[model samples]
Every structure is written in structure tokens, then in C-alpha cells.
Target chain A: MSLPELLRKISPTIWELPVTYKEGMRVPARIIASESLIGGMEAGVFDQAANVACLPGIIDYAWCMPDGHWGYGFPIGGVAAFDPDSGVISPGGIGFDINCGMRLCLTNLTEDEVRPRIRELVDQLFFAIPTGVGCTGFVRCSRSTFRRVIENGSRWCLENGYALPEDLEMTEEGGRFEGADADACSDKAVERGFDQIGTLGSGNHYCEIQVARPENIFDAATARAFGITIPNQVVIMFHCGSRGFGHQVATDYLQTFLKVMTTKYGIKLYDRELACAPFRSPEGQAYFAAMKCAANMGFANRQVILHRIREVFSRLFHRSPRDLGMDMVYDVAHNTAKLEKHIVHGVERELLVHRKGATRAFGPGMTGLPDRYRDSGQPVIIGGSMETGSYLLAGEASAAPTFYTTAHGSGRTLSRHQAKKMVQGRKLLDDMERRGIHVRTDSYGGLAEEAGLAYKDIDVVTRVTEDAGLSRRVAKLVPMGNIKG
Target chain B: MPYRFQDEITTADVAFEAWGDTREELFISCATALLRTMTAAPEQVAHEQKRVIRLKHEELDLLLFSFLQELIFHKDAHRLLLHADSVRIEQRESIFKLVATVSGEPIDAARHRLLVDVKAVTLHRFQVLFRDNQWRAVVELDV
Candidate 1:
């Protein structure tokens, strides 16, 4: 049967597939998207979402966000909550890049003031932060020190003078996770990640300078609360992850789980990438600890990158970061599995929520939100393609249904090869410059692969999410300068 | 060429299918494809360094997976560009053993036209098959 035929419409923006749609499904599968977005989705997305429903101890529904697309095991925008006592943990649900996320920093300067020096700022940033494949970082440390960095996350950055106290307060989990045992990580994972603390690896990873024009503000009150008061304000945003360390940790655990999933745990999977173990088992606990180490490393990685950004901006503008009003708005991790408290069936229960390519959107008064944001909802950063504009969103109280999860980015619509074939990188660079956006990239081929046409429309994605009550639009940010790895 | 990139199989990552008359040739073709994904011009890489790898896996597909993962590890840890120069596979008592020699140099942004980094190999639809008279394998790489 066709995909649409098999799905039952739950709402205008939501679709559901009953457990009978697939064998061994523990619950229903949900897709949150508009009619057009649902029609554009590939068959693999529905299949993968259904595959996730078959996992053990899945509660309520396995959901795909508005920007959902085909992924290895779970759809990129997939979300599922599992019962901690009887549920299983799978690396595929969290992704190889443990805490791959977005960071937004606000500055007092306007686009008009920084537009003239955009080229210089971008050039310096490109040089200060390593980019492209196999690039290392400026931060050097011993193996033992690296262990502490991973275990402590951004706290190590604070002690090393790479981060400020306010930065941690604005970050998710204060830029660290407790009970992150570095000994659970493999030596290979350490060797691969130790030197990569401040580097930006390639493949859709970038640091961009954006502007929040007055005309694009959707919620002036919320925007002002989040520090976007100036007209044509310039902000710095970057998308990256834990780098090689996270990948190695995921790889090591994946192989280990595959060896024992069916042999020792008596579990069967529809896809090998979904290999898993009981959450309370020794192997599962070890992986959870190791995954947290990578998560901490990811936070430290971005913290150091923010340090570099501050230095570059201060040197170029002849003012300190504080004097320039370069304070963090928020940092949100899109890829992770965390133990969170949520009310299900009128009873509060602790659930291990896996959000791959999805962000945690906690509404006002949510327990984990920082005190400053207690009145206002958590800030959600939604990155768009370089050619298009991104969005600043706020979580809503209505997001309790999907465990406070929302879409990550404008999901890809075309393959990298297809995008490259559609446009020449040199021509794209010239075109972007004509449109008042400066870009610096290490490889033209990589740049071509990331052309704006490669992704779904950001405006449409934000509209759908807001329509579905997953998140609320705050402001739209258009790029002024970008540095791509 | 014994290998070709299959663009239609994946939307966000790279996928390739390789085949050869023998398992050794198949391994070399797969290795070459993996290198090509990292840089558009793999031929430009020089043989300035050499590393020998020995691995054993009971399954043929897993052996290939481990072999490709090793290449990615060297790139991330040492910033090296490698191509498998020689591969020999032997089966003994339910274990498939692979020994290979790879040669390349440290990555230089000025010298190499770098592309996206391949994070790890995914087992989605991953297969190693002996069809008809040839050995073939299908693999997808998460970039």
C-alpha cells in the first residue's frame, strides 16, 4: 500500500500509522508535517519511523518532525521516549555526533556597522578556527588533561579561561552532563578527539554571521527578552558537533552492541544501525557514560570556538567582547538522549527521550530551563541553508505531547551529489556576494554540495512547526557572512 | 573501474557499490571509493607514508566494515590520506582474516582538494554478496 493510504490523519499537521501497519510494533508512529511536506517525504522516512516503533519499551508514539527525512535507522527528525527500567538505548537514535547542536551569540552592533568589515571578519575567523577535513585545533593538551576536558565539559573551558560563567548558564545542561566517566571511553576515541577541541569539521558544519532585521521580528516581546532589541542587530551562530571523538565512541559501542544484541540480550532489530541493549545492563550503562563524555567534549568544543569568535571580534572591532555586547542568547543540542521528567497519562514519569536531529523545546516554567529564562520559554535555534534565512524560536507549553521536541534544521531535500550538479561552487560564491553575503570555504566542491537548493524551505519548516504548536517563531535571521568547513 | 557511487540510494550520505572477480580486488575497489569520497582528486595524494593493517572478523561484510573504519580513523587521528595498495583475505576455522598495506601522506589543505569528512560506515542495507561469478559489496557512508 502507498504511504498516504496507510497513514491516518490525526490533525491537519499530524499523521499517524497504527501498530498494525508494521510487524512487532510496540506503539503507533506519528509524523508532524504539513500536507505539502508530507507529500514530499520519501518512502524511506515512513519505513524508518515504523522501524523505530518496533524497538522495545517505546511509549506513546515514535514521531517525525516537520523537517523529517530519510536517515540510516531513525529518521533524521525522529523522537521517541522509552521507559528507563525496561527500555533499551540505541546509538542510532542519538546519532554519531553525540551533541551536534547550534549556538547563537548576540552583539550590539547593527548589520550596517559590520557590513563594511564583513570580508575582513570572515577571513580572520576562517584563519583562527581550523576548517575542512582532518583539520586540528589551536588548543593543545596532554592525554590525561583531555580526559578531564571530556569529563568536565565546559567547566574545563571555564577554568582554562576559554569561557565565561554566563556562557555556561546559557548553555544546555550548563554545558556539561553529570556522571560522565572518561574511563568508559576507548583509547582510540580519546586519541581521535583530544586535538580536535576547537576545530570545525566538514559536511554541513559552518559558522555564520547573521542579522535580525526589525521587519523579521515575529514576537518583539520575546525577542527583546532574549536580547535582540536593536534594529538590524548582528548575531553570530555556528552549527557543529563533538567531532571525531563522538564518532569513535558511537562506532565502538555500535560494534559491541551488534555482537551482543541477539546473542546475549535476545533482541532482534530491523536494522543493524538500531542495535541496542537494555538501559540498566552493564554494557548499556557503560555506553551511556561514554556517550556523556562525548557530549561534554562537544560542549567544550563549542565553548572554545566561542572564545575564538570573541577574540576575533574584539581584535577587529578594537573592543572587548563585553564592551561589544557579545553575550550568548542560548545554545541548543539537537542530537541526544537524556533522562527527562514528563507527565504521561496524568502521571509524571522519568523517560529516556531520544531526539535525533531534534531539539528540546522546554516551555516557560519547565524544570531544566535556567532561572533567567524561567518566565520566557527556552530559545530554539533553527538553522537554514546559507542562501536562505534561519529562525529563532521559543518553546511552547503545548509541546508536551512529543516530549518537548522540535525540528532541528531545514532538512535536506537533495543529495549532495545532486546539489553539486545543480550549481557551480564558484558561481554560487559570486552570486552570494552579489546578494550581500560573504562566504569563505575550504573546498569549492563542499561548498557546492551545501547550496541553498539542497534543503527544504526554512520559512515553510518554521511555519509548520508553529502550526503544529511544537515551537513558536521569535525572529528570522538572514546571513551576512559565513565560514564553511 | 570496478566501483561506482550510487547517488539514488541515500539522500544525506554517500553510497557506493563495488565488485571484483576476487575478494582481494573487491577490497581494493571499496577502499579506493572510500578515499575518493574524502577528496575529489585521490590521484593527487602522494605515497609519503605507509601503514599495514591486520584484522579478523567472522563475517565478510563486517570485515569490510572494519577495514573502511580503519581508514577513517587514520584520517581523523593523524590527518593522513590513505589508499589501500595491497589486500589479502584468508579464511581459516570460521574466521576471515584481512591483511593490507596502505600508503598516503598527511593532509595539506593547500595541496589537496578536500571534500566532506565521512564519519562512519552505516550498516543500513550493507551487504557483501557473491553473485554469479563475481564478488560484490554495497556500502553506505555517513558523512
Candidate 2:
């Protein structure tokens, strides 16, 4: 059904699809979009959100962020919280890139200091950081070390001489988790993760040189808090995740879950990708532990990549990364499951939250947050479609209705196959270059699939993510040079 | 036939694409391509195991994403370096099927190490197009 047909007017900004609208729907489906924006649903974006509403124990409405798009089970901009007792956790909802997220690094170098050196810097980074499909980085570890890496997450990076103490302090989750079991992961997943740590695998995973606004001049106090500097300063921002290991964990468990979903649990699913098992079941616990391992590996991956970026910059500039004032602003998880507390039925209840293709936007003073950030709300990062501007946002109290979540990216506007037919790889690169955006990747065919036109306008999406009270905008970043996977 | 590297449109400033005629062939070719990014997927495994996974439309895509994700998972999980032996895909009314038999032993110090793991198959520029009756799926997996 089309968007207009699917949505029911609830409030001026809120639209709902009642539970009776579809079989197996446990709760109503709500979308926060304007009429014209809802017209864009030929994309069938709301279908996934609708399927999400069918989930057992789903609380409130399974919401659709304005940038909503069709995805596996949960729509691209989906938000839902299931009851801990009866709720189910599905791997598809968390996506394969467990904790795949973005990191912003503020640099002391101003734009003028790097304009002439941009090309060389970009090239060096491209080389220093292995990218493109299957690109691996420099950390070669023994199996035991790899296990510790996964069990420890970003803390592993701190232990491995890759990050500073402050780096760990600034990262979301402090780069580690409370419950990760290395043994829960399969041998195959462990093998894939060992040496693959600290690499930027391709596809939307990128390391871009972003420029802070020239006139808007990122707020000094806020910039200082984030480690950013004066006007026209250059920063490196990138998004990536735990590579093969994480994928294996998700794949193995998804198959495992599908094998017993209807038979063992007696739970029916509207979508197979939403295949799930009880959160405390043997299979569920195993997947959760393994997923945690993948999440930690991802933390280590980003931590190690940060080290490489620092090394590359230091080598080229003949200065230390510290001297250059290169520091991590923050790292937030975009995918993963967490056990947390929320107000349910007007009573606080502990719950397992699965944020797939979404970000955690906890308001100030929530548990699970570090002490320093308790007052300012969780730092939320919203990655835009590559051709657009990505934003740094903070959670607002108004997001209580949203379970403190926000849109993950400027969600896809078109499928990759649809985009490739319209633009050739080389020509598309030339066009991006003509527009002053540097592009590099292993395959042009892959490049065509990722053209920015394939995604919704990020500016509008971020505005809604904020206007809806999910996450408020802090800063907008424009890309300069990028190393594609 | 050699796998061609595509340098087309910018793929999120990170990923790129490559394709081949057959599923097994693309597996081997993409393996070679990914290894070239760093090391290689190696050849001639001492043993092989075939697993068949059937899934619904949504799980099917996730299954496919996980299949490659598993290879990368194990490459990191058990440190096993594998070479693709075979891969076949079949579609049903409400189900899609995949059968892949891959081989390799645990990744050892003696074996060469290459690139990082490919996390999942991305929806970006992803398609399984059968043009001229040649079965070809062009997808850019997020590494």
C-alpha cells in the first residue's frame, strides 16, 4: 500500500496505522512525516516499519523516521522497544554491522594549512588505511589476543597501545561492553576477525576529510568540548564496523534462529528476516554473546583505524598526532542490542533494546552513560548519504516517546541496481570530482551502487530527526576527501 | 576469466563493486579480488563441508549477507582461510535457497593473511540481474 493509504492521522505530526490494519500486528504503526514526504513511499519504506509493528511484545508504535526506507525487517528509520519477558531479539533488526558507526576526529590544522596538501594527505590515508572490498589493516594478533580484543572492545585498543586514555574516556560505551564472551563466537567468526581488525572495509564505510563550517564557525565551547578548533579547521570522520567476524555471528545466529523460530518458540513472524528467539533462550543467549564479541571487535576496529589515521597524519606532517591536536570527538554504536531500562505502562521496566540501522539517543542522566556526558545527553552521530552532509546530534528529553532513538543515516532513496543503470562509474567519479568531492574505491561497479542520488536528502532527514525530538543537531560536516572501501 | 575492478560512481567514499558470470565464479573471483586488497583467500583446502540454508525473502537476503559474512566471520573467528568450492542459489514460492561448500583449515602463522572481514552484503548498488540469460548479481558488500 502507498504511504497515504498506510498512515492514519493521529496528530498533526503523528500518523498511525492501527493494529487491526494487519494480521499479527501487535501494536499500531506510527510515522512522523509530512504529506508530501509520505508520498515518497512508493519506495515501500513503511512496509518494514509495518512488519516491525507485528513483533510480539512491541511497545508503543513502531515508528518511522522521516527518512524511512525499505530495509530487511525494521524500516531504515525504525524505532521500537519490546517487552523483556515476551519480547524477541532478531539479528536482522540489528543488521550485520554490529555496532558499525561513525567517529569524528577534530584536528588542530586549519583549512588553509591543508588545502595545498589535501590530495597528498588523501592519497597517503588511502594507502595507510587499507580500504575497498576486503581491505585489512596492520594489527596481526595471536588467537588469544584476538579473543581478548573481542571480549574487551575498544578497551582492547587502549591495552594494545593504539589509543590514549582520553580516547577511551570520550568514546561511547567507553569502547567496551559489560557482557562479551569470546567462547560464544564460532571458530570461523574468530578466524575472520583476528588480523582483520583496524581496517576500513568498503561500501558506505569511509574515512573522509570534513571541513567545519567557515562562517557558522562551530560553537567554540561545543567545539572545544568535542576537541574541534578554529574556523575552517579540518577533521577526519569515518564510518565502519567489525568486518567478517560480526557478519558471521549475525549470519550463523540468524540461520540458527530461523531454524527454530516458529517450532521452538511458537512465535510467528510477519517477515522472515525478523526471525527471532527469546532473549534468554539458549540460542538467543549464544547469539547475544557472539553479537557482543562482534560489537567489541568493531570497537577495536575503529580504535585501531584511529591509530592508523594518526600515524598517517604524523608521518606526512612531520608532527605527532598529539601535537596536531588530533583527538577523538566521540564514537557511537549504530547497531547492536543492549539491556536497559525504560518507562513501560507508566512503570519502569528493564528491557533488551535492539537498535538496528538506528542510533541510541539517550537524554541526559540516563544510566549506561559515562559520567562526563550525563548532563549533555548522549552524543548521537547521524551519517548522511555520502554525497550529503552528516551531522552530530544530541539526545533530547522529548525523545522519551521514541525510546530515545533517532535515524541512523540519510536513509536510502533508491536501490543500488537502480542507480548503476543511470550513471557510469568513471563518469560518476568525474562528476563528483567536478563538484570538488574526491573519490577513490576498488571497483567502479561498486561505486555506481553507492552514488549519493540513491539516498534521501540528509538535510531534511536530520531536521526531522530533530524536529521530532529524537536527536537535536549539534554540527553539520561536509566532506572534502574520502577513502572508499 | 579475470575479475574486472569497477571504478565507477563514488560508493559512499568507501566501497566499490566487482562482478562475474556465475555465483561460484564470482565467489572465487571476488575472493581473489579481496585478497589482492591485502593477501589472499588461499587455495586447495584439505577438507570441504556443504551447508544448505533455506530462508524467506527477508531472511534469504540476510542469509546471503551472512554467507559472505560467515566466511569473513570465520576468517576472523577460527582464523580459517577458505577458498570457495561451490555456491548455488534456488528460489521457491516463499523461500530462497543457497548451498555453498567451502574449504580451509584454521588460519596458521604459516598461512598468509590478507584483508579485513566483509561485514555484510549491502543494499547499495546491489542487484542480481539476469541479462541475456547470464546469471549475474552485482552487489557491493560492506567490508
Candidate 3:
């Protein structure tokens, strides 16, 4: 059956596919999107979602967030929870760019203070941070040091003076996954990560400067709690991932899983990319351990980049970061299979929740949140394309139905080739400049591929999210400067 | 006819098709396609740099995957612009082994107008098939 015929709309924002819709499906599939968005979604979105529901030990349902799109195995913005005892773990479900995530920083400066210096700031940021493919960061370490980085995560950065003590408090999992075993990582993975500890690898990865527009503040109290009380408050946001280290880790484990998934575990996969092993098996455990290493590397990578951002601000303004009130708001991972305990069937159970292209949106008072944000839910940083606006949202109790996960970003709606065909980088650059947005990119062609038209409308996505009660909007940020890799 | 590669598929990521008269030629065409994704042509790269990639896999599909992954690894780890100049693939007792010499140079902004950085190769709809005396492969790169 076709996607529209296969899907049954339960609510205006939620659609359902009965388990009987597909022969192998063990549970029903849920797609969270408005009618318009669903109409525009590719058929692969539901196909992949149904494929995930068929996986063994999946609890309740496999959910696709509002921004769901076609992905390799799990649909981008897909969320699934597998029983630790009976379920399986698929690397493709966690995505190749492990811990590809968002980090937001609150600054004391306002839009006025940054507007005049936008060009200079972007240039400085572009120069200070490496971009493009194979670009190296400032943190070059020996193989041993690289091992330490993977094992310790942001703690390594703190010990090495790249991070502050409080940074971990606002970061997910304290920026470290406890079970990370560097030895589980392959030599090639380590070699790729050794020199790229803090670099911003290319292709949609970026560092952006934004301002919290007064008119866009949805919840003043929540905005104040997030350090955005003043209208036009400047903020810094960056999007990056684990770089080659995580890519290699996912690649290496995928190959290993494909080799033994059938013979060792009696598992059959509809897609080769969904190759997996039982969570308790050696292969599964080893991949988890290595995945944790990559996860930690991702945290450390962002931590170092955060430090560089602070440095740029400090140097440019001739003021210490502390004096400038440059503080971290939050850092969240969008791609991960985190071991979390959530109530399943009204029974509390520990399940491995795989959120690919989706962010964990733990509701108010959820464990792991920093003390300052105990009253409010964890901050959800949703980045938009360079030409659009982004958002800072707080988790809602309504997200429990989907394991407390929400859309990670305004999901891409166009292919790079299609985007390039519709827009030219030179014209885009000029347009952004005319709109008072400064952008610095290493490749003009890359810039064209990331044109704002390439992504779903962020406003619509975030509105659907809030209306669906998955998350509550806190503030909206408009870009003033952007640095793309 | 020499193998040819084309970027004709449209998805959120990059996808391309490569075809050749033989598997070896298909592998070469695939490598060229992977490199061309980062830049327009091989002529834009210099031959001052060299990277030797070797891998052994039990399946031909996997061998191609590893071969492309090796090129990406070199690009990320060493900033090399690779163009596989020579490729040799042989099967020994059901094991497919590939060794290739790639010539390139460090990425120079003045010469190399880079494109999207390919993070890894995805197996989504990935295929290598022989049809009507011609070999063809479809690959999607996670950029």
C-alpha cells in the first residue's frame, strides 16, 4: 500500500500504522507530523519506521518525530526503545555521525553589540575554527592522549584546560558515557580522531551567532531561567559531530554485525544497514562500548569548540569570558542509543533508547538535569538553516509516549544537488549579506547545498512540536553571523 | 567501454551510480565518483602525495565498501585529495582482497575548490550487481 493508504491518522498531529499493516511488524508505528508535512514526506519515512517497528523487543511503538525524513535504516528523527534483555542494538539506528548534536551558549552581549562587528566576528570565528573536509583542530594529541579523550569525554577537556567544571553539568550524560572502552575502538578510528578532537568537519556543520528576539520569547520565565531575560540577548550556537572517529566506529561495527547477525543471533534484517546483534551478545556489547567512546569523543569535540568560541568572544571584545557572562546553556546529543530507564507498560524498565536525528527531551524533574534547570525541562536546541531562525525549547511530559524524544532540527527537505540547482552560493551570500547576516564558508558550493530552502520550515516544525505537546518553546533566535564548514 | 560514474540520485545525502565492463573497472569508477563528490575533477588535485590502501573482505560488496571507506579515511586523517591511479582486486579462496595506489596532494584552497565532506558510506540501497555482461554499483555517501 502507499504511504497515505498505509497510515491512519489518530490525531491531527499523530498518525498510526497498525502492526498488521506489515507482516513482520511486531508493534505499531507512529508518525508525528501535520497533514501538510506528512503529505510532503517521502515514502521511505514510513517504510523505515515500519522496518524499525519490526525489530525484536521494541516496546509500544516506533515513533517518527515531526521532522521525520527518509534515512538509511531508521528514519531521521526516528525514536525507538529496545528491551535491554530481549531487544537488539543497531548502529544504523544511532546514525554514523554519533553524537552529532547541538550546543548553545548564552552571552551578555546584545544584538547591538554584535551587529556592527558581525563580519569581523564571523571571519575571526571562521579563522579560529577549522572547516572543510579533513580540517584539523588545535587539539592535536598523541595516540595515548586520543585514547584518554575517548575514555574520559569532556572530563579530559576539563583536565586539559579546554573545559570548565560547570560545563559538564549542562551537558547530557555529563559529557561522558561511563562504559566507554577505548580499546573497543579500532586503530583507524583512533587515528582519524587523534588530530580532529575539536574540529568542525564539513557538510552542514556550523557555528552561528544569534540573538534572542524579544518578540519571539514564548515563555519569559523559562527564557529568564535560560539566561535570556534581556531582549535581543546574543547567543552562540554550533552544530557538529564526532567527526571521523564516530564514522569509523559505526563503519567498523556495522561490518562486524553484518558478518554475524544471522549466524550468531538468528536475526534477519530487511535492510543491510540495520544489521545488529542482541544487546547482551559480545558483538553488541563491544559495539556499545566503542559507541560510548565515540559518544565521549563527540562531547569532548564540542567542549573544545565551545572553549574556542568563548576565546573568540573574549579576544574580540577585550573582555574575559567570565566578565562577558559567556556561559553554556546546554549541549544535547541527537544521535545515540542511550541506556535510559523509562516506564514501559506502566512498569519501570531500563531500555536502550535509540534516537537518530532526534534529541532527548526529558521532561521537568527528569534525572541527569543540572540543578539550575531542575524546575524547567532540559533545553532542546533546534538549529535551522543559515537563512532561517532556530529555537530553544523545553521538554514536556507529553513526550513520554515516544521515550521523551523530539525532532533534532528542521530536517532537510531537499537534496544537495536539488538545493544547488535552485540556488547559487554567490547569490546566497549576497542575499544573506543584504539581510544583515554575515556568513563565512570554506566552499561556495557547499554553501549553496545548505541554502535555507533545503530544509523544512523551522517555524512550522517547532510549532507542530509545541502544539503536539512534545516540547514547549522558550525562545527563538535569529542569526546574525554564521560560519559553515 | 570505460566505466562511467554519474550523480543522478536525489536524497538528503549524496548518491551516485558507477558502471563498467568488469568489477575492477567498476571499483575504479566508484573511487573516482567518491573523490569527485569533494571536487569537480581529478585534474584539480596534484600528484605529489601518495596513499596506499589495502583491505581484505569475504564479500565483493564489502570489499567495495571498505575500499571507499579507506579513501575517506585518508582524506580525514591526512587531508589528501585521492584519485585511485591503480587498482588491483583478486579473490583468494573466497576472500576478496583489494590494494590500490592513490595519488593526490594536500588540499590547497587556491586550487582545490572543495565540496561536501563525505562522512561515511551508507549501505542503504547499496548494491553491486552484474547484468547483461556489465557490472554496476550504487553507493550513497553520508555527508
Cα-based lDDT for every prediction: 0.93, 0.71, 0.90
Instruction: Write candidate 1's Cα lDDT for B1-143 as tens digits.
Output: 88988888888889999999999999999999999899988989998899999999999999999999999999999999899999999999999999999999999877778888889998888999999999999999988
For candidate 1, write residues A1-485 as lDDT tens digits.
15657798889999998999989899999999988889888888998999999999899999999999998889899999999999999999988988999999999999989999999999999999898998889998888999999999999999999999999999999999898999999999999889999988988899999999999999999999899999999999999999999999999999999998899999987999899999888998999999999999989999999999999999999999999999999999988889999999999999999999999999999988988888789999999999998999999999999999899999999998898899899899999999999999998899999999999999999999999999999999999999998
Clashes of 3: 0
Tell me each candidate's TM-score.
0.99, 0.81, 0.98
TM-score of chain B of each: 0.97, 0.64, 0.91
Worst lDDT run of 10 residues, candidate 3 chain A, spans A1-10
True contacts kept of each: 0.73, 0.24, 0.71
Sort by TM-score, best first: what order? 1, 3, 2
Worst 10 residues of 1 chain B by lDDT: B108-117
Give the candidate order by descending DockQ.
1, 3, 2
Model 3 TM-score? 0.98
Model 1 clash pairs? none
List the candidate numbers ranked by lDDT, top first.
Answer: 1, 3, 2
Worst-scoring 10-residue span by lDDT in model 3 chain B: B1-10
Candidate closer to the true structure by TM-score (higher is better), 2 or 3: 3
Which has the higher TM-score value, candidate number 1 or candidate number 2?
1
TM-score computed on alpha carbons, candidate 2: 0.81
- Measured by DockQ, the strongest candidate is 1
